[model samples]
Target: MAKQQLAVLITLLAFLGPAACQQQGLHICFNGWLKVPPLLSYLLCPPGSRTTNPPPSPSPNPAPPSGAGLSYDYYNNNGSSSYCPSAESLVKDAVKKAIDMDPGVGAGLIRLFFHDCFVRGCDASVLLNTTTSKDSPTDTEREGPPNKNSLRGFEVIDAAKAAIEATCPGTVSCADIVAFAARDASSLLSYGKINMKMPGGRLDGRVSFANETDQLPGPFSSLAQLQSSFREKGLSSDEMVTLSGAHSIGKAHCGFFSDRLPPNPSTMDYAFATELEVKCQGNEANMVHQDYQTAYVLDNKFYQNVRANKVLFDSDDVLKTVREVKQNAEYPEIWERKFEKAMENLGRIVDVKSRREGEIRETCWRVNGAGY
Candidate 1:
């Protein structure tokens, strides 16, 4: 009777699929011929029924499928460990060293990672320089107005890459290096408050175009615009809010947000607006901290400031009106936890639709054999 029931259950699950099994409040475990749901496991298998230990626990960070042409163990596959204790540690140390030399580098690294991943699946194409004429409107990604003078930390990435190359020698991909540096930069800037382990194995992309810069969300985007932008990148609304917390540690150029100053601005704090106007008067290049309370720290103060309408960017200010984000704003601890998970998700999204399409460039700035 038990054998008959087990066979029937297996047949049912065969057609139901994993999603259906989960919806029925049961965990699916595939073991060759036997498709056992957790609820029925004890009854079917009994005590020591043709078994060799229980199923393994789910991996905390599972590698994407091989067809994706990327692996979390990319460094291991490339023998990076044979060269050093751990390539990730080497990269982390290099990032810390760079930050030590320039305290303001964290924000740029974070932004660089964000921009790179958003446009082209984190292939590190953003690092490529324009092969076309410099004056041409169709310059490289770095030459776009949104990034022309604002995006930074390329030198820090180059430094970290040089250090990694000295140890691994063509083993690490620039995309993975950028991801690692960004993770380390966030943790270092936040005083070890937002650290998360990053998985490696990303490849570098060959193409970079200036016009693609328009895909990135701007400082003046509205709440709906921000949501649409993040969604287009496969990030959730919660993730969007969590990632936006990065604004806590960065500064913005006056030209980016100065328009909010004139014509009787209402969303901004009176004193803050006046200060910005005075500081930015006739000088669009002046920069100001995004979060005044904890400009250098990478904490939840950005959320607090957004709630108080003290944020620098119009897009950030609009987050308060987002119901889900507004609710999370009142609880910084929740945001921190969500932020960590969201950042992990951010790294994962960099892998989607990005395999076998590019190569690991010998140098980040130019394609291999392209000549200086």
Candidate 2:
């Protein structure tokens, strides 16, 4: 009698579409229905819903499983509204003012955030200056080959940090300030098209190393390599492709992709290759727009170009062949929605509590105690 009732429930769920199943808060959670008891189904998911996978358990007060001591309320000051609002507004206003003076600064801020996050989990380590002798081979992450002469927008972050320190003293961390600046820049550069609410309270990392940048994916990175890099940071392949849309704005130094040109042409379009060759003229220092069409706008045209085989970097081109990205390439709405969510998640990658293994740097360039 119990078996018959379970079979009836399964058949009813099958008849109900995913919409109905979701409305009833029920999920299938397994393939072999007979292996799962009927009571288990009710516990896993509510009735009238069918799903192939179990829903993620909610953690109302989650802590970082890695013991990094990060939390959503790491910066909370017991219902003190003044703490976050003042810092957030100051960072946004500073970034907006900077971008207004030079629109290109927006792309620089986005890239700066990536360079910082990819190396040392977005702790504003990239903003650190070389403390040792200038001629030394090993300096800071900012001086590394992957970053030197390539990364920009340090001054913008510096400006925002200075402004914030004036109002809030050492209450706001430079890491959080950098994150907020990047979010503001993204929204402003896209002309308010790609706005995302960023969570703050990240503590500043004290250590910065040039060698750690080996984790960063280069322009020549294969799809597998890019996926592996992002996966290590708790991001999915879909998110990797979504974040690559940032190429929609920014310029790349010609040296980064010159190897892809001429007799050994890679995935780049021939006409586009010829144009880049003319623009760059074999100069390593010369720069070209990552997306010539709508180069200053943050949009899905980057993916469209990738699909058409017109993007500059091999890494950007390969995103089109990824199954999940390929399907979403044509739908701007879908990609934009996914990209926003991914960006939000990316912002959380380095959210460490100030109380543990971190500090709120009085200045972005050096640790709080270390003298400039």
Candidate 3:
């Protein structure tokens, strides 16, 4: 019954769009209920059914995910047997050092975490022990079709892991380190404006399969296909659009978006497509920035690009057609704030109750030796 009601609510949300819902005074509670005014409460939350906690007031310091064993500073917990006081700071420092040498590395770090979580619940499965140099064929997430020869910034993770391990040996999990580095990278990339207190204490998983890469949405996904992919991951369509803002700092190989080349005058901008054709002509290896105007910044400019029909992917281009989402490009301070919340929700998708039960890999790549 509750499932049916939730399904019905989702259908309504799909029809109404988030902005329309907001205009109608419909509030989406984090608990998955639509918190409405007393007049509409019976229709939304229902009488005597599950109740949602009131939304938290916006604060510089937000609370961590509940029951996650995660905290703003889990490694430094004085009561813990293995305590590394500066665990997070070490990651931030490493991220800064790497980004200083190559600013593009910061975006790569963010993409790394996004890909990892989408594939295997943010367990660092994306960081499995497999590399281009290895001739020994291994079936790991790193070897997956979507990830092979694509994901970068592995050395950045390696540097952070080395720093954490040197300080506390076996205290921090590689998964937590990856999450922290991604958080630090985004903070640094956005000049500290987009900051979130990332939860710690996530454990590394021992299993990683190449086939699981299907969980990731492709560049060519239609609007419906993209929504369904995000839906499967417990994200809303609004959140999907919000997360797409990260593409402000992203790039894609030409081959990935070749179908749009020559441009479909309807969805994509013709002048932009012609320019890309010249830029990528005869070179499948060339990379195109998701937001050509500000390829290095993390902001809502990606939405503006979509509004101009200058985006690279069909998924990104479709965002502009949604009235609620297109508003993210104009007066989008609200969109930036929602981006942070959506990211927090993305990080929360992984269940952490069994974190202590999972192994802590000695290296970000390989699992720890026997009895970890």
Assess every candidate by TM-score: 0.76, 0.76, 0.77
Q: Per-residue lDDT for 71-168 in model 2, tens only?
A: 45444556653255467778888888888898788888887877777666768878888433333234678866678788888888788888877877
lDDT, candidate 2, residue 281? 97
Worst 10 residues of 1 by lDDT: 24-33
lDDT by residue (tens digit), candidate 3, 1-372: 597896787667555443443332223311211223333433433322222222222332333334255566777779886589888888889999999998788888888888887765777878986523233246777776567787888998888889888889888888788888888888888887788777777778766767566557666545655665566566777777888888899678887667677788887888999989988985867987777887777888888888788888766777776665668888667887887877766666564533544677788887666332
**Residue 359 of model 1: what lDDT?**
72
Best by lDDT: 3
* Model 3, runs deviating above 4 Å: 1-67, 130-137, 351-357, 370-372
Please list all clashing residue pairs in model 3, or write none if there are none.
none
lDDT against the true structure, per candidate, is: 0.69, 0.70, 0.70
Report lDDT (Cα) of residue 31, candidate 2: 20
Least lDDT summed over 10 consecutive residues: which range in candidate 3? 24-33
What's the alpha carbon RMSD for model 3?
A: 12.4
- Tens digits of per-residue lDDT for model 1, 1-372: 698997897766556544342332122221111223344543443322312222222432233222244445556654444233467877788788878887678889988988888776788878988443343344678976567888888987787778778876776778888888888998899887777766676788766777566557677655655665566666766678889999988788887777667624457887878878887885879998888877878888887777776777777888887666665667767777777777766766554444455676778888666776
Q: How would you order the candidates by lDDT, starting with the best?
A: 3, 2, 1
Query: What local lDDT score does residue 191 receive in model 2, on the 0 to 100 scale?
Result: 76
lDDT for model 1, on a 0 to 1 scale? 0.69
Which of candidates 2 and 3 reaches a greater lDDT? 3
